[model samples]
Target: MKSSTFKYSMLTVGIAASLGIVSTANAAESAAASTPTIDNVATATYKIGAIAQTPVQSNKVTVNITQSAAFSLTAKNDDGNATDDYNRSAIVTPKGRVAFNHTLTNSGNVEDTYTLSLAQGGTIPGSTQDASSYDLAATNVTYTVYNADGTVKKATTVTGTDFQNTNIVLKPNEHADILISAKTVGNVGGNSQNLTLSAASTFFTNSDTTKATLTNINNSITKVPVFKITSKVSSTLNLNDPSSKVTYTITVRNDETASYAANANNIIVFNGLPEGLRLADQPNLSVSNNATIVPGNEGKGSSSADDSVRVTLLNLEPGQEATITFDVQKDQNETLTNPKNVINHASVSLDLGENQVIYDSTDGTDPKQNTNVFYPAGDDSEVTDGTTNTTTGSDSAAPLVANQRALSIVSPTKKEIPTSTTESTQVTHSVILSNTGKEVEGDKPGEVKFTITPNANNKVTVVTGSVELIYDADNNPNTPNAVYTITRDVNGDNDLSTAVPKNGAPPWTGMAPNSIVTITYKVESNKAVIDTTETTTVSLVLGGQDVPTLGERIAKNTTTVKGLKLVKEQALNENCAASTTLTFTQADVAASPGNCIVYKITAFNDFSNADARFTFNDLVINDTTARFNNKAQVLTTSTSPAFTIRLAEVADANVLPTDNTYGATASSTAVSGTVTNLAPQKYAAMVFAVKINPDGTTTP
Candidate 1:
């Protein structure tokens, strides 16, 4: 065999060098460095015969390395986490910033650049996505990535899913830490949101064959303190007492939700009493455990010069409650409109700082436009402890009546009237109308109505009214101060102004405050249910200019109307109808036998119902001459045929059945008739003529 010049050619082949890592790398950890080529050649020299022959060698084998791309991303925690992890946790303040720490590593043999992105409720590619307790949407969320070393890579903060094409360049086996920040909006400090951060390798990004990416998650929850306020008040002021004060009750409570019930300290409650009102007494305050009230300069009491009241509570815990009650009286010096109202507004500061207000009038109300409620007089049912209670809006208390316009009746008398059975009697009730509120002027004056509610029977009803108005120009209750007296007749009108002439100026339309109006009522009360209230409502108007609200309910006198009673009786005549000259008399008279004797029977119908359809229908009547049917005893009675009962006509407004003929033959022994449709309060008669067949006690 010829071993002539058997030499290996110089070989050059591309080969992969020491790969850094097959797994992902994170911040503070090394990654696979640049791709290094393996260059080596195999050399062999063999002489032909161990002599000085020419050396031959095979071509040297060579290898070159190619780049392998790899990178990783991880989320870090603020609680001193030693190494980066896949998940991070944090608590976010509402309307404030919450940042999540993260790290990115280029775990590859070659240097690589990366692009960062943040996604909410998103999934990692090529893996099964998962959900947490609270999955928050990345939409509407904004974040900015800042270098952990205080270096600003991208000056612009990115929002939502758009990463703005920002890039992060890193050396092989190098890593970088970044902070992702976001602000939570409109959350009441009780909810949570999950976020994800992803780092894509730009070296082989979107490559046709190979791609590398890392994704990690962060969970954030909202934490803050919240509270609820409640307020309540009575609709009307207590008028019986001279103090004339209105009371209000207010309560403050921590939020009911567990996450929102954070501890609060040094709570301050301020209630600004409205104009035309003054504090009357000391305020009453009560609280739960771990809380106490701090009094203001008024010492839990009220001052005439103080326009507002303040109370402070210390160390109010979650779900704890505190209550306060105060009274306000009308200021006599403050002059206001006649039918106006006063409103009180309140605010609650969490830590005795006005800027840290937890509940206020403008909490849920419109900022651009302020709206308040005005409750009508005598309809004050909307006062809730807090604005979230009985009423809808916050800040304003239920409207309290501030008008000094009031009227009432005094010296009511009770009487009974006696009358005959057939006659109608009249009853009267008199009272002095006293004005205790503001002046009742001509242009803005209202009327005190005198109403007469009947007893549901037609016996007694309201007929008219007579008013004797006495005007006092000087606004005094003394007798001599009333300078003018006018009388007017109000016929059948109710709860309206009296039609009286004020020196021929139509009617007197004005009355000063504390004046007296003497009005006499002509009402008929039949039954015993005394309709005592004779005042009208507060809605009043004068020539449609100024609407007035003036009257308070006042008691009126009691009247009773007696019912009618009638009785009638008829006696036996003892004689025939022929010999007696009197028509209907209870007297003894003689009559000849064979004379005409008559018998009568009447059908009377009297329906007393108030219904007009009440009547007597299909009425039938019958009469017999049985007294003359027997044989005559000695000077006693007449025998057969002495008297015959037949249909005979008798004078009756409501005629007998069928044209007054009683429905019987002329010579019949009995009489019968039918009266159809006999109305109420009417009567019908059935009569018969008898032939005294020469049969009378004396004649026979």
Candidate 2:
């Protein structure tokens, strides 16, 4: 273990650095040990020519390319390119094939030469990637190749079963070309494809053989398309009048930002309209776009580009709007006053390109929507004029009827006198009024104010009676003249008396046209009549004024001059001597309905007390000139004095004319028997004697 010091210099350092590693080189130069000078030195050794196994890792390459045209064409190539490692990686080449020898020999027997013929029929590859076929025949032997998998990759020929000394002839080989082309139709991805060639045969050495015919096969290529649509509409619509037209605007926009290359064809539609409200077919609609519209886009043809259709849309696409206008007319004959509140079917719709889109048909802006829109005009139409009929109750007080203009008296022609101390009058009246204008159910009746005009010397007095009114016209504000008094009929068994008010309104007040009212009374003369001469004073009144005289009346003296007379006579028993003639003359010539006059006559008895009682004769004579003479006879007798007789009724032939037969009846009776030669106007006579003397012995 001796240590030696080594010298180091700059020059030595430069030389050593230039030599790259001096220390390592010197260590390899000398390794000598004293014992046998065997070097026990570390030597770096490598197995340069040593038989050693080293694993060689294979490198694989992959590409993520889509099935492009170039990739598909490479996959369709039949023969691979020998220059490229990927195409010619494992190519099979034949240097030469072993030939089979066939011979036929015979030692003795016929000294002739035998000839053998071999037939070769086979398929050969037209290109490196195509399949081949081969068939060989020698003498009585034959061979064939069958591809069970249907793809043939290699060429093969079979020899006969045996070979002998024979001259053989063989047929020529055959070649054919195969076609391999690629096209893409759809999306493709993932791993490369391996094309395989298969073979099968019954007379071959092997059953079948397969080789990778092709690799990295690509799929067909194509392009796809997409579409989008949007729709919008106006915010407000006005359907104020059913007869007025309404309009709406709807716009649909079709957009394309999709990966697909195809253009879009679109349809727009809407639905849900109120009942009876709908759009007219072939509606006015227009469509536009950024590009010039094709004929199909303008609804010219059935291509996908067709854009517009005459229809309403139930649903709208986003951002698209439509406006539709239509005219409406309301039913004028509707009976309901508020028919506008009723809803009807109305809709705006679009027929979109896609048949799957849905639409709405509900109404939104109808004119009948608000109460103010359906206000009514005033019109009161009626069928007939209104009238009032009054059926008065027994205990009811007088009623007031409005709008009366006339009156009617129910009682017959009458006059009043002061004959009795107290007398009452009862009257009834019925009044009717026709409406001159439009009549309402609760309208007030017109007012009727009946005023009696008294005589000029005295005030008009209310005698009695009241009127019944059907309607309260007196207090009605609707009528200008509302108060009326109608005299109504009174009911009673005995004579019913109604007091006439001295100061109240008249019963026949406010009478209308054709209206009637009456006043009746029991009148008596205050003084006795002298010789049937009676007179009193009364004043008739109307409309608060006294009625003037009608015509000249007959004087009291003139009535007296037309004296009472007997116009006819009838005969009793004709027993009176020289029958007195019955005379006749006109009585007070008073006017009657038939213009006839009444008459009075006095009959006298002239017969004195004689042996036979006087018999007065009475007779009836048809002729006015005929007198009661001896033709008169006795009929009956009476004891009382002669009474007045009523003669025939008479009429002034020239002035008081009447029907020929007078409307009258006549009768008479006689008194007790007392005298003979009775007046011709009287009847029958008889005599009787005292009955006292017969009891004494002498009967007279």
Candidate 3:
């Protein structure tokens, strides 16, 4: 089949010349061609003609076309680094903030839109499995998007989900920076939080919808423990009392959730005693949670100025506390030039280890953990400082005195009761005698004795068999030390017939400074309404001389009048006899709003007395809603007994009395007249009427 064959070929390239669309080779040569170009069209026509012995044919074609779409995106840190771009980890304190910087670039040949957001779930790097996860709440994070030239584009405080919903467009080779700032929640410590960031392009596609341009880039923050030291004293020092002890308590606290440890050694606590104070005993040390204490130097001598106590602790975990308590006493030989100006002071120091990690917000530099802290720093005006890391707490005591004796007495029963007509009335009184003075010298207890004198009109039939006595320990009357003796005045005379030796002698010893003795006795009153006051005075004789300041300590016993005792009660119902007694509480009258009240008054005389008269006046009805019936009735025994009852008179209808209704005034006239010559053991009754207004207009 060797036959002559005609062959023709034609080549054409569709070119959008005005749009800068060129051949693949030219496009690769010019970097500007990567940028998108606007709409433009160009046409190229080709024709070929061939002539031979037979027939020859050729074909040419031209076509118009549009550029294909393309998209690309890249995300990096603000430094333009491609890997390990953002802050990987940071040590922060609770309620502290950290900032992360990132950049989003459109590296494709065409313009593109990108969405940036933070990933919510991920494990924090270099953190335990139980560490807390990052919080993506809008309230905790703030973000700002900036243009390539550093101009702010948008600033907002929106959550990751909200930011992802926004579309950010960029041209080819254009980039934008984003600053994501976040703050740790309060009280979140001992754990790390991971913040993952993501950037996705609208035109980009991935098999997993959760991932796009950038994903799972973790930025983490951790909260470290904080340490603080404090101290306190028990009480004020007493210079005159050598046996007095003052306790000092020093405390160390790890106020965070992060556990802290030292290298090769535990935390050391040191305290130095102030001048004029000596350590009394070993310190009692206690640790909370998982920790152990090692005792160091205990205060051994009182003469050295450097006398101090030390304790070491291991494995002080988060939220743990430790305390040290020790007692100090005033040195008797170390006399102060100004006794009143003496100060007993102590100090404590805490050694944070060399490797302790402290997270502070003020400075970015990580300082060495090896630091010493003194409680009551130099600024504390109450404490004097020997050094920067040493604090001194002080307390002052009053000046000493020689042989100071002060005495006082108190009677629990000082009121008087009247004598009875048929028989004699007996009354008992309790008197407390105390030595309110400084310590006495020479070991001689203060001398204290009692003298009783009865009223001549009502002499004592018998001064009781004997009086009771008790010693008061620690000023508590209920807590008695031992029983003693009480001198009795057998007859109604000024002299005390019952005698006991004084000055730490038999039956009256142990009455030292700040000591108390209680005495109790009984007396009888013979005549009614007479001088029945059985006055008893306690005298204190110290160092063979009377304690002049022992003021007249007197207690009297008298009787109350035996005539009538008046009692009044209110009732909601008109039938005063059937109504229950008013309890005088809100709940008792809450249910009964409309008051149709009746007041029942009773005069009771239990004791027999001659020529007795009972009168009732100024019976105040304080309820503003009450309108009295202006009438009253009296019922009494003894047919011939004289009694009268009348309405309570008011002087003014507009001026209100102190305790009466607004429209009522104080009255001087008697509401019920006197009952004269009433028999013994007899009672009288009276009733008054009142009504409550329904309109509430009378309410005060």
Candidate 4:
């Protein structure tokens, strides 16, 4: 065998762009991880006498790559564009929704997965306001992952049910687009909230400082809103339904919120125009990118009911939005004469076309749900003439809620107080009312009435005239010397009701919208008895005689009297140090050998409870479980049985010096006493004591 030496070139090993970067084609093909074997051998060619023989080869050599994990995330809007708010901000009203977009790439050498999470509230890195406060347990949110071209898809959504098992797998510098759709919780017309979305590398956590969602919602009026169609008063407020004209626009969006999309055949819009209002202009249908609307189902006024307008929409793809526009005028035949608010809202129904798949209805936002302060009879206040409610139904937008009147309760319904049986005892209760409409409630004679019904045991009356007013007026923080006066209701039927605000007091017809009115009343204990309750029923109605019923409520104030009490206290005799005097002090003291432990039991009745009336009769006291039997002084000086028990009583609590009721069955083990007739504001007492044996052992 002959060998020939040939000059060879030196070789170097390295990746194109450091690791799993785009510059390398085999970046994603590196499947061999921290496990086993890639072998390489060197081959040489040799020639002898100008003739090349077989090539020579060397032994095998192996190389390895250590696993590395790292990632990067960027935020964008729905259009995949960054915004002025760090590319992560949006503004919305109640019942509305907003989406936060993000792109994540596994900028590492290996295929990896990361855990995804969404949090309700937390301040972002660049927010001026504190973290938004969440309400209503409404934590419904969703996220969709898609390839760069929006073609490759693994799952439809990552919901709360399966979010734990959901993951995004990427190799090397591969990336995926994440769309997080945050739904508004609920009827929060005047409130806002914030959220944070986060992700953590599942297997390898060496790079953890690369995660946190921080989008501020400081400018979003609709911080939270309901889903579907939203309606707004496009025209003016307080127009005569019979003669006045107004316009409204209904916005409908097709958001594929369900786990999967169901192919449907029908999408019809039905609007029951409010009373006293008639359809004037035929609805104009408009569709957004890729949406199709069919204008054939227009049923304006031809139907039996006043629901004048009915329009049909067709083929609304997910993420597409459609709108319905129309006009309405007051009906000449309407009977409502005085100024009253009228609401015009609509609904939409969908048919899945499948057998027995019941139709789904989406009701528009009602004024009751808006809950924002509303002006009546066309308010010209500075509140921008016409207001909008951000909530809408998925199928139909809830037009604005408008009615002549309605009120809400802001305080808890139940109230209680401790009772007293003293005849002529006085108790006071304060009931506050808030006017929800834009009128000054209770300014008229019968606008607001309270039916105060009392039993024979008590008398209820309103607190009126110059009462001692304790208020914080001196800028001294709640200290009061100023006399604030309130009004009185003097009706002959034993019913105290509010009149016009004649004096500078309450019930003064000055209650503004969303303002509170407080009415204070007193309950006189006429013949109240012990263990008895005083329940006074109070009924309220907030509507004028000119207008119909607006709102009504009933409340109850009750209290029950308590009975007798018992107390037992003990003091040490300190080895009988004061035996000659036998004076005892109810205080802390240590006992030595042969020290006597004095025990006093007293039965008492509260003065404010029964004052001068009720009495506790034939009361008996029993003593058991007294564990001092062995330690008590039974034998005097450790010699003979001198088990003598002594008793003493207060003179006033006894009928005579030897009264049976005042005497107790006193013993070294236990003691008890009784009271024949324990009158109100009076007490009875019995005293007894025990002594410890000097030798630290119980004397037999």
Lowest lDDT block of 10, candidate 4: 1-10
lDDT string for model 1 (456-559, tens) is 44444444433334455454555343322223325433333433544544355566666665555455433322223222211122233222332324444545
TM-score of candidate 4 against the unseen true structure: 0.27
Which is better, 1 or 2, measured by lDDT?
A: 1
Task: Please give, for residues 421-498, the per-residue lDDT of candidate 2 as tens digits.
Answer: 122311122222222211121112222122222223321122343333333333344644322332423321111012
Off by over 4 Å in 1: 1-72, 77-96, 105-112, 119-163, 169-175, 184-195, 202-211, 218-226, 232-249, 258-269, 274-276, 280-304, 310-345, 348-700
The per-candidate count of clashes, in order, stands at: 34, 143, 6, 24
Q: How accurate locally is residue 397 in candidate 1, as Cα lDDT from 0 to 100? A: 46
For candidate 3, the per-residue lDDT at 195 reads 65
lDDT, residue 504, candidate 1: 41
C-alpha TM-score for every candidate: 0.32, 0.16, 0.26, 0.27
What is model 1's C-alpha RMSD? 45.0
Off-target runs (Cα >4 Å) in candidate 2 are 1-231, 243-247, 254-262, 265-276, 280-283, 289-700
Error of 1 at 195 (Å): 4.4
Name the lDDT value of residue 450 in candidate 2. 25
- Which residues of candidate 3, in runs, are more than 4 Å off? 1-86, 95-97, 123-131, 138-143, 159-161, 183-187, 206-211, 228-700
lDDT of 4 by residue, 537-583 (tens): 55665456434222325455564443444444455555454333443
- Each prediction's RMSD to truth: 45.0, 71.6, 37.0, 31.6
Candidate 1, overall lDDT? Answer: 0.42
